[model samples]
Target chain A: MTGRLRALAIVLGLAALLIATVLADAARRRAARDAEASHRLLVRVIRLPDLALSSSSRWLRHPSQAEPGAALADLPAGLDVDPAGALIGPPRAVLEAGRSR
Target chain B: MRRQLALLDYAVGALGRRAGKSAALGAGLAFVVALFGAALLLTDAIRAEHERLVEEMPDLTVQRLVAGRPALIAESFADELRGLPAVRAVEPRVWGYYFFAALEANVTIVGTERADPALDAALAHGRLPREGAEVAIGEDLADHLGLRVGDAMGIPLDGDIVFSPVVGTFGGGSAIRSADLVVARPAHARRLLDVEEGWATDLAVDLTTEDEARVITRRITERLPGARVLERRLLRRTYELTFDARGGLLAFLLVPALAAFLLLAWERLSGLGDAERREIGILKAIGWATADVLAARVYESLVLSLTGAAVGIALAYAYVFWLGAPGLWGALLGWSNLRPALDLAPALDPLQALSLLGAVVVPFVAVGVVPAWRAATLDPDRAMRGAE
Candidate 1:
């Protein structure tokens, strides 16, 4: 009798755990669906570097014209100091160059 | 039923009495479960995010390779790709990494030949840059830099400083890789990245039919020797491979801990103490059947396994969803700074979770069986005498 009771307890406990797992998994699946939907919307709506404007205004505000005045002359090759005080350098190599400086 | 309830109650008391031993076993099991479960959850989240982003990715990416390194491709190459069959459109994309020295972050600078396609690209702000003088920033970047629409943002280029109007910030939907993105018009991107005129970072090819991806890849290769082609369909596999490798490395690091736990478990089960042996004998001497004794042992194992698993899983959930997975994130997904907006919703696959639980429980319960049976079948008198 005691043996049967202990066995039953073990089975019941396992069943409980499995039930919990299933419920949690269901909730997780719903969350995943919701997240993916939102993510799709986000990616489409907030695209970067609208090419129409990305290049046309590289220097609307020169760094040299800042209140404190940026030092544009110190920049090296593969980089351009736009009028807007933003440094546009070649991909990672220019970044490396800047880091070394 | 009453006797079974009593047995469970007794087993609980027994574990309580051996608190040190039980705690060690339970804690080890919990830690293992947490580690495995958390890794699986985080990987799933990362994969989901990647899948969402990949929908917008062009069918193929064609880039120029010079001396086995990526160099800018000419505008002519885009025209070449457009000439191919089933090739719908070829877009020359200008993108590069821009390091923000102040924040120690690398921003993705993308140059586009087309205009912001949407009526309101920055829906939150309901505007795109008005002219070449303006640029759009990702919401996270704007937050980090304390930028708002109309803020004049400046960047340092080689030998120059360029300031652009921050026309808008994009965010508040599903977190994409927009946090560190700086989108500008094509000309601005070219000048900023210093790609010479007539060259682009790469060409994004849209195919009329995806079934011809391999064929297009071959054709592009033949026409443009030394051009690297990336197919969008295969990106998921690449991401999966990367994530698997990182997960494997994490699992490998847990080997020592698991080994220690195994050793401890073996000593506790295979090397039973005299007191435990005598107690089993006392039960048998008192006319308790071998099956009853076995049941008690099984109950103990089940209780331990279930308690440990439950605690571990609960902790894993909290660790991943609530705490945001501190150590694991840095190790698994920490490569580039152009990171997707991290929104790891608590997601679990039933099959995967169940399999992990089974992996933890089955062996644990089975291992205890042999020692339990051995203890129970002993001659009651002999066990009582403490001779065996």
Candidate 2:
């Protein structure tokens, strides 16, 4: 009777330990995946550089000018500019460069 | 001594016959535990999905306000933003809210330039809105309106005027909040909103450093007052809080169920009375030690717990995964059909299973210990006299 009881105890203890291990492992994996997904998202958000307006005189809003002062500098690479802003930069730059020539 | 061995042999045979039935009961209980554990896992998965979507959203979204009313941020502002030293990509997004009185539905029209990649990835059907008049509805909106790709639904603009041609549909992650989005080109949105030179919204300034997010936000606030700049982490937390109230209610519901399980296990183990007590005494009198008596009872209790817990956890997983946490949002908030945004993996791996086993087995073992110890230490002479 004692030997039978001892055998039962060993079996039950091992089974209980197995169940606990499975639950904990599942939880740990879920947490790790969540952390990885969050990190990926943060990386995407932080990759872009800050954009600044050009400081060229041609595009400056001069108070004395007849029209609202426009920045005549070239639009930065890979940027899309509205049609109105596109016309001023090339001509203004040419005029300024010619003065130096 | 031989007579005592025969009784022990008979008891062992009886246990063998009963073992099958006990195993079946344990299996049923294990299924329930597995279901419960699965539901818990599914909840975690849905939250993770929400976090992923929130993280993908722009770091700082800038919208223009005029006289406390929203105005377009000039198209040139995108260029202006692009030129800033701290700015990375200044993507202009055009959007406006539309109210459909007949359907009592409110929808937002979002427009993006063909050059923008973010808008492109969100598309679910048809090509991007190429012309100034075409639009793409969100999947939920499409379903509700019974509109499909190449289907035309008139969009009402200001002054009771309406625009025609719903060209496509798109799908997004958040079912709770993003159900009514309609996508179009920036020009189309601008026309609908009557804004000629600017955007309804602009996602500006991707900073290089984490610390710089605060600095850049301050600069933008100083430069363009009244604009809101939200960091990605803050936005993710905001979305998480949307489910916080629901989670509290779920916790409350689980507490009673857990208590009931513990009580049921305790009663089942404790119900053995004098006949069983005598049987235990008879075995102990023949030289069985306290450890042996305790071991058998503990073993029996552990088996019952493992079965019950496994079944419960499995049932919970099915409820969460297949049926989608039914009666959850409705019970918490009067909203039915709140589809969780993320896919949850609800499997009881080795560790979780072990934890659950411990939760059940430990208490029952402790309860059985005292009774087993008393039976084991009983003197054979006294026990026999008392039995007679």
Quick one: best TM-score, which candidate? Answer: 1
Model 2 CA deviation exceeding 4 Å by range: A1-101, B1-35, B53-55, B63-83, B96-108, B115-124, B156-164, B171-179, B190-199, B236-249, B329-388
Clashes of each: 38, 67
What DockQ does each listed candidate score? 0.07, 0.03
- Best by the DockQ measure: 1
- CA shift of B62, model 1, Å: 0.7
Q: What lDDT does each candidate get?
A: 0.65, 0.50
* DockQ, candidate 2, vs. native dimer: 0.03
lDDT of 2 by residue, B312-349 (tens): 56456556655656665233222112122333444434
lDDT of 1 by residue, B344-375 (tens): 55556678788777877777776776776888
After superposition, the stretches of candidate 1 with alpha carbons farther than 4 Å from their true spots are: A1-38, A41-97, B1-24, B113-126, B172-176, B270-275, B286-292, B331-342
Chain A vs. true chain A, TM-score per model, equals 0.34, 0.36
Q: After superposition, how far is residue B261 of candidate 1 from its true place, in Å?
A: 2.3
Candidate 2 C-alpha RMSD relative to the actual structure: 16.2
Q: Cα deviation of B373 in candidate 2 (Å)? A: 5.0
